[model samples]
Target: MDDDVERAARKVRDVEQAVSEHVTRGGPVTGRASSPDGAVTVVATPGGPPQSVEVSAAALRMGPHGLAAEIMRIADRAQRNANTRLHQTLERVVDPRELTAMGIERGTDDDESGWRR
Candidate 1:
């Protein structure tokens, strides 16, 4: 029992260190996308809404409705991209079994709870 406790504590410490490294140096895992006509671009970070958006002068001519649609489309793509990157990062820092225990499948975009589930 003592050995088991020691092992578990070691695992926890390792996980904590890995998480710290990820946060301090791994950088933000982001996803990015652009409009079909290349007039708009969007970037998203894990567990958050879009972090940045860029619209070219030509995109302004798209008007309200067109611009809205394009933005939505690009935002969706960016979110998916961010999710993928976030998962990859997590895989590197977290134990696969722990993620599985939490019902987080590898490569799945179902992390609607900001990196939870």
Candidate 2:
């Protein structure tokens, strides 16, 4: 029992080390979004950068409705791009099992989680 625990601990430690080193391997991905009129801009860095932005009516050359739609489109694209990068980066160093051991679960409860190795 003690040996089993020790083995698990070691494995966890190794995974942690890999994650730490992996993150340092590259810079964060950054993205920019703008309103339809090119007036309002949103800057985002999903993995490392932000919860920061401002919106203003001054951005609306086509008026408020168009500006709002543009903002949504831009933000969604940025979010998807960030997610893609994050997923790829995570795949490089940590498997789902490692994430489960670290209490980082993904996917729906019905779907299950973790990797084989």
Candidate 3:
């Protein structure tokens, strides 16, 4: 029993190490989305940050509040997309269940409460 526990711990550690290394070597994961009017565009990366945002000249016509709302909406969608892609990519490197066991959320875009870390 003790040997089994030790082996399991070792395996978990190995998996964690591999995941870290793979992430370190992998390219940044990003997702992009634009407003319905094509006035706002956002490129977002996993962990909830916009890598870049682009606004068209037409966006200025929407007024300050309207443009800000559009940008926020687009950025949210882009972040969700990036998270989905990140989860999918991680699935290629590790079992989905393993990822969950390691505290990585594997929720879909529709799952608003998912993706906690």
Clashing pairs in 2: 97-115
Q: Which lDDT tens digits does candidate 1 get at residues 33-95? A: 787577888887655788888999999999999999999988877777676666666788787
Best of the two (1, 2) by TM-score: 1
Tell me each candidate's TM-score.
Answer: 0.65, 0.49, 0.65
Model 3 Cα shift for residue 53 (angstroms): 1.0
For residue 57, model 1's alpha carbon misses the true position, in angstroms, by 0.7
State the weakest 10-residue window (summed lDDT) of model 2: 108-117
lDDT of 2 by residue, 1-117 (tens): 999999999988997787667766665444455554556555555444434445665664557787677767666555444544555566767775654454433423221121111
Ranking according to lDDT, highest score first: 3, 1, 2
Clashes of each: 0, 1, 0
Best prediction by lDDT = 3
lDDT (0-100) at residue 73 of candidate 3?
89
Encode model 3's per-residue lDDT on 1-117: one tens digit a residue: 999999999998997787777777776677777776679988887776798899999899999999899999888877777767677778877888865665545446762332222
Candidate 3 vs. truth: CA RMSD? 6.6
When summed lDDT is taken over every stretch of 10 residues in candidate 1, the lowest stretch is: 108-117
Pick the winner on lDDT between candidates 1 and 2: 1
